[model samples]
Target: MRILVIGGSFGGLTVAFSLRQKLGARHEIVLVSKEARFTFIPSLPWVAMGWRRMADISFDLAPVLSRWKVGFVEAAVIRIDPAKKQVHTAVETLDYDYLVIATGHRSANEAVPGLGPFDGPGHSLMSPPEAEEAREAWTAFLDSPGPMVIGCAPGASCIGPAYEFAFEVHHALARRGLRHKVPIVFVTPEPHLGHFGVGGFGKARQFLEGEFEARDIRYRTSAAIASISAEAVQLVDGPSLPSRYSMILPALSGVRAVAESGLGNPKGFIPVDAHYRHKDHPAIYAVGVAVALPPVEETPVPVNFPKTSNMTRQMAAVAAHNLAADILGGAPVTRTLSAECILDMGDRGAHMFADPIRPPRNRSEMSIGRRWLWAKRAYERYCLWRLKRGWAGPASGLLG
Candidate 1:
């Protein structure tokens, strides 16, 4: 059997390594990624804040995948033909018996004009390059302190990072004794604080509100950002705010290749069944933000459902297991979507665990303390070590 994975990020790497482990010496596996290095995305905020260097969070993919006996292709996937079972990259075209679409998301900066690192006034922490750019921008901001805006654009699912960046910026500025001079504002489309695109978790709204209040980080919920300029951000319903520095998390959209393949939805996300198999293409599967997921519930302002790293890992495991079952004789496994996250507030953090993602769950736990900050740092080290060892077991306790 020939299996092709179309990405090399958290979801793609997990699928490739786990599937290779499940069908060792029995099938050919190829992992394709646009970048040569794999970055620990959750730590990008630290990179932006100058707490971490790019090298600390990224490693070469060639060495890691080669150790697992998987072929690595470092090229952008220009197109995907599900009908023909072929993937066309910038360099070559490859055909596969089974295809896993873990292409993740493309930052939809175009959705919000003037909202990006380059060609815009605001910065982002989505990628290593962007984070590095943000670091430079932040350094410049420190030379002259003023009002700052930190928030997520409409349709954005990656909400946790926005919160993390806001707090980290606060901590960094406070350390420099410039936090009071630069008033920080958090603006989100979520109906309330801590909704996180999955409705409100256990006491999350109250907890976040309290934290923001304590820090004097003003926030605007259900805010619709019309656009951003070099000096200010314009809101649809409210008055424009003068901002000397802005960090806006743009919405995530489907990759252009997948969207053009005619296999994805209008938003460019691939629709998958309960087992993570593509709805129409049985041999194709999708995990991570590349897979289409409906929101837990609708709100006044639009909010896309989140696909965290831990949840994506679970989806990848299930997809890999099912693909293995297709070749070998066994029942496929089904895993529920859950989230375990540590929202780092620099010196302190909050750990939240939700089973089944939505509310009314069997287990919904949340705690806040300085230990969680230490735990988050420890998890980062453990994750890098585990990935280096090619361990792809159940991601039950993994923090993201």
Candidate 2:
């Protein structure tokens, strides 16, 4: 049997490595990705603040996959044909008995006019290159301090990074004795602070609010960014804020290749069942931001639901288990959609665990302290080490 995984990030790598362990040498497994290296995305904020370098968070994917005896293809997938069971890349077309679509998300910077690294004056930490650009921008900002605005664009799902970058920026500026000179303003589309794209997590709202207050980081909620200018950011609600430096998180959309495949939703996210199998195509599965998930509830300003790294890893595990069940004979597993995150605030951090992801959950835990900051740093190293060794690190269950 042949299984193909299209992506080399958290979800894709987890699925590929887990399946290889389960199926052993009996089946063929291939992992395809556009990039040659895998980057630890959570550390991008630190990269932006110059606390971490790209090399510190990224490693070549070919060597790791080679050690696992899995074939690696470094090419952009142009299309996927569920009916034909084929994946077409820029250079080749490969057929597979089972397919996992973990292609992740593309930054929908065009959603808001003049918002993005390429077309706008603002910076983003979504990708490794973007993080490097942000680091350069940060260094330049320190040379001439001024008012700054940081927040997520409307429909942004990955909101944690925005908060992390904001606090980290505050911490960096304060350490350099430029905090008073450069006033920091946070703006978000969420109705309130700490909504985090899934309503609000336990006491997270209060905790974040208190932290922002203590840091003197003023914020504006229900803020829809209309456009970004080199000199300032304009809101749809008739407010214009002066900001010499702006870092706005762009909304996520489906990769163009996935969208054109005719297997994705309007927003380009693949619709999947509880088992992470595609709703229309049984042999195809999806995880991470590539899968479509509705918001817990609607708000005045649109907010796409978040898909954290932990939750994505959980989805990958479930999909891998179900695929093994189909081929090796076992009970299929279902995803729990659990989330575990450690939000770094430069010197301090907040750790949150939400089972089922929505409110009124069975388990919801949150805590903040300096120890968590160190814990988060350690987790980065541990995660990279585990992934490089082709192990499926804990996503859920007791260890998670």
Candidate 3:
């Protein structure tokens, strides 16, 4: 048996490792991805702020996969021929008995004019280049500081980075003794702070509100950005916000390859059943941001469900189990996803957890303090060390 996994980030690596451990040498596992390195995307805001470099959070994917005995193909996937059970890449076409689509997301910069860093006046931290560009802009801003805008566009599901950037900016400016000179404002499509696209968890709303107030960061909730210009961020229904620098998280859509191949929805996200198996093709499975997930509830502005790293790991485990079962002869396994993340706040941070990912969960907690900051840093190092050596087991606890 052979399995082909598209993507080399959290989802792909986890699936590969999980399968290698479960199936041993009985089946072949190969991974295809455009990125040569596995970057810790959650730390991108720090990269933009110059606190961490790209190398600090990223490692070459080839070496890691080779160490795990998984075949590695560095190529951009052009399309998938489901009927033939083949995946076409620019380098070559590969066949597979089973396929796992974990091709992350494509930032929909077209959703809002001037929302991209290189293409427009706005800045972003989505990719390595974008984060470096934002860092350059930040360096320039320090010389002549003014009003700063940090927020997310409508339909943005991955919003934690925006919040993290805002808080980090506050700390950065204060450290430079420019906090009073430059006014900062946070805007988001979420109806309220701490909604996190999975509904409110514990006292997150209150905790974030308190933090914002103490830090003197003004915010606009349920706000939609119409466009971004050199000097301001115009809202769809409200007044424009004057800004010298801005970082906005745009809406995310599935990659063009998946959409063109007809393997996913119109937006490119694959539809999957409980076991992360494709509804139409049992041999095809998907996890991570590549999977289509509905919003938890309706809000004034659209906000899709967040596919956090922790949730993606859970999906990978379940998908690996089911795929192995099909080949080895066993019943399928299914499990609910749980999320836990520590948000870095410059000097302090917040630790939040949600069992089952949505409301009415059995266990949920939110805590704020400086210890979480240390814990986050420690966990990041731990993750890099573990994944570098091809250990993807669930030993990292809730931090994973």
Candidate 4:
């Protein structure tokens, strides 16, 4: 059997790498990706703040794929024809017996005008180049400090970064003795912090509320920002939020590549069963942000769907095991996803972990923290180090 996995980020690579070790040379596995490199994206904020450079977060993908004896194709997937079981690319069409889509999220930049390039985009840290842009923006902001906002818009799945940036900015400015000169505000669609991109983490509501107050960081939760200009963000509900410059994390939707493939749902995300198989097509599976997550619990606002790296890996593991099972003729195993992460505050941070996501019965949320900031740093280094070396299993070092 031939297995083809698309997208080369954490989820896709996890699927490919796991299959390589488990299946050996029994089946052909091919990975299709446009870029030649894999970036440790969670570290992009450090790059943006000039704490790390772009090169440090990125490593060549060709070497790892070759080392594992997996086929690598450097081409953008233009379309996925599930009916034909083939992928259309800019270069050539690749046929597959099984397909795993890990295309992540298609950043909805234009969902808000001026966010991507209202005339010109101010800055972003979603990708490597965006991180560098943010670095330059931070430099200019430091030179002329002013009231600033780090906004997370409605429908935004990756909401943690905005809070991280806001907190880090506060710490950065304080180190320079210019914190009083700069007003740092946190704007988010979640009603509370630690809501993370996943509903609220345990005690995150109380913990973040206290932190924001103590840190003197102005916060506006449940905000649905409509648009942004060079000077301010126009809110959907009321008046424009004023600022000298804004770094807003716009909402995330599925990538157009998957959406146009006719395999995606109305939200451009694929629907997968508990085993990670596509609902209508069992031969296909999906992981990461490209798979739609139902709301954990309904709120007055829109659904708060969580998509963390830990959850993505669990989904990939199930998909890989099932794919291997089909080739080996055995029962497939399914696994439930949990949440884990270390949020950096620069000066100090927190470490939190949870299980079963939406746990059953009376079990409460699991969490613990007390300036385990050093632990967060160690976690980040270990994750990047393991993935680059393909030593990702057993550790499963999730750095969401």
Candidate 5:
């Protein structure tokens, strides 16, 4: 069978690697990506903070895929025709017996007025290039004390990074003996912290609220960032927040080509069924942020998205199993992926929330501690080591 995978980020690379290992040389596998390297996105913050260099996190894709004997192509997918079971790239049309779309999320920086490309006061850490730019800005801040503002625009998803950056900055400043000189502020559209794009996990909201108070980090919850200028961030119906430099997590939408092909939902994200088969086409399966997973709850304003890297991997694994099932004539595996994520809050991280995969009835369980933070760190190291050895790490606990 000819299996073609699109996008080379977490979902794409992970799925390809796993499928190759599972199926061996019996079936042909192909991977299409715009870039020649795979980035471990979770390490981007460390890269931005100078804890690790870019090369430390980036791995050459061609060689790795070659070692696995999977066909690799560096081309941007321009369109997909489910009827034809083919993906049209900028170079040529590639046919697929099974298609997996894992193009990842697109940062909709333009969603807010003048918010990206580092054109002015606006900056982001969503990509490798942008992370470098933000790093430069951070270095400048370190050399000279200034007011720092980090936040998310209205309706933005992936709120965890904003909190992480804010806390990390504060910790870095304190370590540099400039904590008193630098003023840190955090802004987000979520009603409160721990909401974490899933509506405040357990007592997470209260914990985050108190954490900032103790850290002397000013924050505004339920705030919608409207426009960002060189020295100021304008919030809709809220007081303008001042800053010398700013980094905000923009809302993520579907990829340009997927959106252009009219294959995605209103949010520009594709929709998939329980088996991860595209609702519009059975041959096409989508994993990762490319597929839209409904938000857990309705908020005062939209501030969450269901698509995350871990969730994306789960989605891709499910897609791979189901696709294999179809080819081998077996039952498709369907399992709910539990929401197990660790959020770092500076000195000590907190482990919050445990839900059965797909959460049962507005229910989420959680626990917090310094031990959990250590465990999270252990997990990161374990994952890096495993990846280096060509292995995907074990599953993370929902509340570890």
Candidate 6:
């Protein structure tokens, strides 16, 4: 049997390694990706602040996968023909008995007018290029300090980075004795701080509210941005916040290839069952951000569920187990994912843990300190080292 994985990030690599270990040398596995390198996305905020570089967080994919005896195809995927059981790529078309879609997300910068670093006055930290662009903007802003705005646009699922960026900016400015000059404002679509698109964890809302207040960082909740301009950010039914520099996380949509192939929903994300198998295509599986998950609760402004790295790891493991069962003869696998995150806050960090991503959980923990920051940094190095070596050990309880 042959399996094709269409991505090269956390989801794709974990699925490939897990399958190889389970099936041994009896089956074939191939990975197709547009990028030749795998970047540790959690470190992009540090890159934007000049605390880290791209080389420190990324590594070439071919050599790493080659060491593990997996085939690598560096090409952009054009479409997947489920009926024909083939994938068309820029380089060539390949046939497969099973397929895995983990193409990640596409930043929907066009959702708001004038919201993109390359095309407009706004900036983001989703990609390497965008992070580097943000770095350049940060350097320039330091020379001429002014009021700044940082937040997430409507429909944005990933809110941790925006918080991290806000704290990092404050810390960096304070270190340079310029914090008093820069008035920082945080805006979010969530009904309140620490909702995290998954109901607030124990004391998370209180903790965040207190932290922001103590830091003197003003914030707007349940706010919708109408548009962004060079001099200010306009809000819907609210006052315009003047901002000389801005970084806003835009909404995300599935890649065009998946949407055109009729494999994803109207928003281009795949719908999967308990085992991470596609509802329509039994032979196909999806993990990570490619899978569609509804918000835990409704908010005044729209917010989607966050598909974090820890959640992706669990989904990949479950998908691999179920795929193995289809060929190796066993019962299917089911799993309930927990929320685990180490949020970087410049010099300090916060560790948030919930038994499940949704509410009414048996366990919820939240703590903040300098030690958590050290742990976050240490985990980044350890994770990259392990991944580069292709060690597909256990996939549970990873603090991402």
**What TM-score goes with each of the models?**
0.97, 0.98, 0.97, 0.94, 0.93, 0.98
Point out where model 4 deviates above 4 Å: 117-122, 359-371, 395-400
Clash tally for model 1: 0
The local distance difference test score of model 4 is 0.78
Candidate-wise lDDT, in order: 0.89, 0.90, 0.91, 0.78, 0.78, 0.91
Candidate 2: misplaced stretches above 4 Å?
A: 396-400
84-169 per-residue lDDT for model 3 (tens digits) = 99999988999999999999999999999999797789999888899999999999999999998999999999999999999999
On a 0 to 1 TM-score scale, where does candidate 5 land against the true structure? Answer: 0.93
Error of 1 at 320 (Å): 0.2
Residue 158 alpha-carbon offset, candidate 2, angstroms = 0.6
- Residue 204's lDDT in candidate 6: 85
Give the C-alpha miss distance for residue 165 in model 4, angstroms: 0.5
TM-score of candidate 2 to 2 decimals: 0.98
* TM-score quality measure for candidate 6: 0.98
Evaluation by lDDT, superior candidate among 2 and 5: 2
Which is better, 3 or 4, measured by TM-score? 3
Q: Lowest summed lDDT over 10 consecutive residues: which window, candidate 4?
A: 391-400
True-structure Cα RMSD, model 1: 2.0
Alpha-carbon deviation at 12 in model 5, angstroms: 1.3
Which is the better candidate, 2 or 3, if ranked by lDDT? 3
Clashing pairs in 5: 195-200, 337-357, 338-357, 353-366, 354-365
How far off is residue 313 in model 2, in Å?
0.6
